[model samples]
Target: MLQLEQFEVRERKLQFIKEYDVEKIHQAKLIVDTDISSSVSLIELAHMVGLNDFKLKKGFKEIYGTTVYNYLYELRMQEAKKRLLNSSQPYYLMI
Candidate 1:
């Protein structure tokens, strides 16, 4: 039927969009990890990845099992620990 064919086409288009959005979500995570020193907000990240905040948040959580802020916070804390222990502290002192 003509209606069935049209529905299939529309569904395929929606699937394409969903795939693109997933790629953007991964890109957003990479951006955050690559620039851990810079303070990037949720809206900024969504804009950078060509997604809206709601989709970014939802997709990111679905894929990564955590919110963006929590992920960023964990990375920042780990980076801070690395820098603090490796910069001035003696090798033995670090351990």
Candidate 2:
């Protein structure tokens, strides 16, 4: 009976996480885009957005079709390319 009760509790928690996954994923994307240059870990991101690490990682990929790191990396690279093409500033200074 105790084991069954624990299982039920776990399931409830997971259900709650799933219910909020969409909102959490949106928040995660905003956090990443807001600071693409900064190094943020999954735990940090999940904490900031009120999600567990596993749910955040899985939901982000499900909603965005890419991992969080990859999404941020692509954004950074695109921004760098745009700056390099648009600005006459030296490459070293940009770095």
lDDT of each: 0.84, 0.84
Q: What's the C-alpha lDDT at position 12 in model 1? A: 57
TM-score of each: 0.71, 0.75
User: What TM-score does structure 2 among the candidates reach?
Assistant: 0.75
lDDT of 1 by residue, 1-95 (tens): 99788767666545645788979999999999999878878999999999999999887776676899999999989987887766876656654
Question: What does candidate 2's lDDT look like per residue over 1-93, in tens digits?
Answer: 997887676665555556677798899899888888889899999999998899898877766668998999899999989999999999999
Judge candidate 2 against the unseen true structure and give its global Cα lDDT, from 0 to 1.
0.84
How many pairs of residues in model 1 come into backbone collision?
0
